[model samples]
Target chain A: SQQGEEDPQALSIQEGENATMNCSYKTSINNLQWYRQNSGRGLVHLILIRSNEREKHSGRLRVTLDTSKKSSSLLITASRAADTASYFCATDEAGYSTLTFGKGTMLLVSP
Target chain B: GAGVSQSPSNKVTEKGKDVELRCDPISGHTALYWYRQRLGQGLEFLIYFQGNSAPDKSGLPSDRFSAERTGESVSTLTIQRTQQEDSAVYLCASSHRAASSYEQYFGPGTRLTVT
Candidate 1:
C-alpha cells in the first residue's frame, strides 16, 4: 500500500496563476521529495525537504513540511502551460532508502 | 546516454508468457531501483540494488517477479507466467549515492501490456 496521499486529485489553472498541492503521509519519514512527470515520460526530481526542515524554495517552487502533522505542500508560482503534468510526493523513512510514493496530483495549466 | 535509459519503450505480450525489462543506469551510479505504476495508481517499489551488496527485494509482489543487476550498471526485471493484472508501466531509477544524496534519475519506462 502507498504511504502518502495527495488531495485534490486533479487541478486546472490558468497560466501565471499559482498552483498548490498537498500531501499527507501515514508514518514518520526522514525526508520527502517532489517529482514532476510529463505525459508518458520519466519523472524529474523537483525538490527535497528533510524532516528537520520546515520549508524550502527552489526558484518558483516552494515546499513546506510539517513533521508533527505528517503533511507537506508544494506551491508553484507563476504557472505556465509547460508546467502541466502529474506531480508526485515520495517519502523515505529513516534508514530506508526505498521510496513510498503517493497517488499524485495532476495539474493542468491552460494558456 | 547521459541519463538512465530503458529498452523497448513499449512491450506487448500474451498471458502466461515471460517478459523481460531492462534498465541502464547512469555511469558511476551505485544505487539502482525498479518500480511499477499501474493506470490511475501510484508508483510501487519493486526492487533495489546498491553497489555489490545484497539487493533489497522486499518490495517484489511475488516469487514470479525478480530483478538482477550486474556491476551497478545494467539491470533486468523478469516476470514469469505473466497475467493481465501484471500489465503496467515499469520504471527504473538510479542514484549516485543512495544513503547520502537522495536524488534519483529515472528512465522513460517500459509500457508492458499483457493480453
Candidate 2:
C-alpha cells in the first residue's frame, strides 16, 4: 500500500512565481523527505522534516509538516526554469528503514 | 567524494532473458536501496540492505526480483525471466547510515527496456 499521496498531479507557473504541493500519508511516519527528479532519472534529496519538526527550510525550498493531520507541504519560492521537474514525497512509515514514495507532482516552470 | 554510481546507464533485453544492474554507493555509506519507476509514476521500493542486518525484502514485487550487497560497498539487483512489464528506470540510493532521518544520495538510474 502507498503511504504518501501528493496532491496536484501537475502545476504550471511562470518563472519567479511560487509553487506549492501537498502530500498526505496514511500511516504515522518517522520523517518525511522531499526529492526532485530531472529528466525522469536520478533523484536529488531536497529536505526532510522529522515527526517532531513543524517546519524546515533550505535555500528556496520550504517544508511544513502537521502530524495531527498526517500531511506535509513543499513550497518553492521564486521558482525558476531549472526547478521544472517531478517532485515526490517519501515517508518512512512508523520508523521503517525503507521509504514509501507518493505518485509525485510534476511542476513546470515556464520562463 | 564521489556520489552513488550505476551502470550501464541503459539496458535492453529480450523477454525471458535475465538482467543484472549494479550500484556503487558513496564510500562508507551503510544503507542502500533499490527502486523501480514506471514512466511518470513514483518510485516503487524494491529492496534494502543495511550493514550486516538481514536485508528487508518486504518491498520486492515477486520472486523474479532479488538483490545483494557486499558489506557496505557494491550491490547488485537481478531480475530473472524478465517481462515487458519490467521495463522501467531502476534507481539506487544510499544513506550514511540506518534510520530515515538521513538524506539519501541517489545514482543516475539505469533505464531498462525489456522487449
Candidate 3:
C-alpha cells in the first residue's frame, strides 16, 4: 500500500491556536494533497504540494513537504470552530493516477 | 456549476442482495473516481475512469464489485451478493483532467448498510 500514515490520530485545539498534523508516506510520490471532511459530508480539497516544492500556503493553511523524509505536514493557523473535521493526506505515487489516502486526523477546534 | 452528485444518499439491503450506487460527475470533467470509506476509516480507492476507460481497477477488492462510466458523465458501481463487509460510504469524485495539480470534486456519497 502506497498509503500515507498521519500522526496524532486526533487533535484538539483552541480556536486561536494553530493545529499541525503530520503525514508520512512509504514510497516516492509525484504530489501530496490534503483534504478536509466535515462530519458526514464529502471531502473538500485543501492544498497540494509537489515533490519538488518544499512548502506552500493557502489562506491560513500552510503545507510543508520533505521528500528526503517522505513526510508532509499541514498547519492550520488560528483555527476556527468551523475547521473541526477529519483531515486526510493523499499521495499520488510517481507512476499512478490513483491517490492513496491515510487514515486521517480528526481535528476538533473549540470556540 | 454543480459539484459531483450521487443518488440514494442512504441505502439498506439484506445480505445476498445486489446493490447499485450511482454517481454523476461535474459536466465536463474527464476523470471520475470511486472510493469506499468504512466507518471511522480513510478513503479506499476502488476504481478510476479516464474518459470512460478504466486503466486501473486494481483497487477493487473482489470480482463481486464492478463499475462503469459513460463518456465523461455518469458512473454506476454495482455490488453483487452484498455482504456485511460491503457496508460502507461510497464516494465519487471527478477532476477536470487526470494526474497531479488538478483537484477532484467529490459528491456527498452513498451510505450502504447491509444487514
Candidate 4:
C-alpha cells in the first residue's frame, strides 16, 4: 500500500502552542495533501505540496515534504480550539488522481 | 457554485439487506470518487471515475461492493447483503480532472448503519 503512516496518533496542546504531526509513506508520489476532518464528517482540504517541492505554507499551517526520507510533517502554529480536528496526509501518484491516505493524527487544542 | 451533495444523510438497515447511496458531484466536474470511512478510521478509497474512462475498482473490498456513474453526473454505490461491518460513512468527492493540482471537493457524506 502506498498509504502514509502518521506518527503520534493523537496530540494535545494548549491554545497558544504549536502542534506538529508527521507522516511517512512507502513509495514515490506526485504530490502530498493535508486534510482536516471535524467530528468525523467530510474532510476539508488544507494544503498540497508537490514531490519536487520541499515545503509549503498556508496561513498558520506549514507543511514540509522530504521525498528522500519519504516523510512529511504538518505544523500548525498558535493553534486555537477551533483548529482541533483529525488531520490526514494523502499521497497521489504521478498520473492517477487516486490518493492513498494515512490513518490521521487526531489533535485536540485546549482553550 | 454548489459543492458535492449526498442523499439520506443517515440510513439504518437490517443485516442481509441491500443499500444504495447516492452522490451528486459538483457540476461540470469530470472526476468522481467514492470512499468509505469506519468510525475513527481514515477514508478508504472505494472507486473513482475519470471522464468516460473505465473506473478504477481496485480499492473495492469485495464483490458485494459496486458503483456506477453516468457521464460524470451522478453516481451510486450499492452494497448487497450488507453486514454490520458495512456500516460506515460513505463519502464522495469530485474534481475538474484526475491529475495535477486540482483538489477534490467532498460531499457531506451518507452515514450507513447496519443493525
Worst 10 residues of 3 chain A by lDDT: A1-10
Candidate 1 yields a Cα-based lDDT of: 0.92
**lDDT string, candidate 2, B21-115, tens digits:** 99999999999999999998999998889999999998889899999999999999999999999999999999988678888999999999999
Chain B TM per candidate, please? 0.96, 0.98, 0.97, 0.97
Ranking by DockQ: 2, 3, 4, 1
Where model 3 places Cα greater than 4 Å from the true spot, the runs are: none
Report lDDT (CA) for all predictions.
0.92, 0.95, 0.92, 0.92
lDDT for residue B104 in candidate 2, whole number 0-100: 91
DockQ, all models: 0.69, 0.89, 0.79, 0.70
TM-score of chain B of 2: 0.98
DockQ of 3: 0.79
lDDT of 3 by residue, A7-93 (tens): 889999999999999999988899999999998569999999999999999999999999999999999999999999999999987
Better of 3 and 4 by DockQ: 3
lDDT of 1 at B33: 94
TM-score of 3: 0.98
Tell me the TM-score of candidate 3's A chain. 0.97
Candidate 2 vs candidate 4: which has greater DockQ?
2
In candidate 2 chain B, what residue range of length 10 has the lowest lDDT sum?
B96-105
Query: In model 4 chain A, which range of ten residues has the least summed lDDT?
Result: A92-101
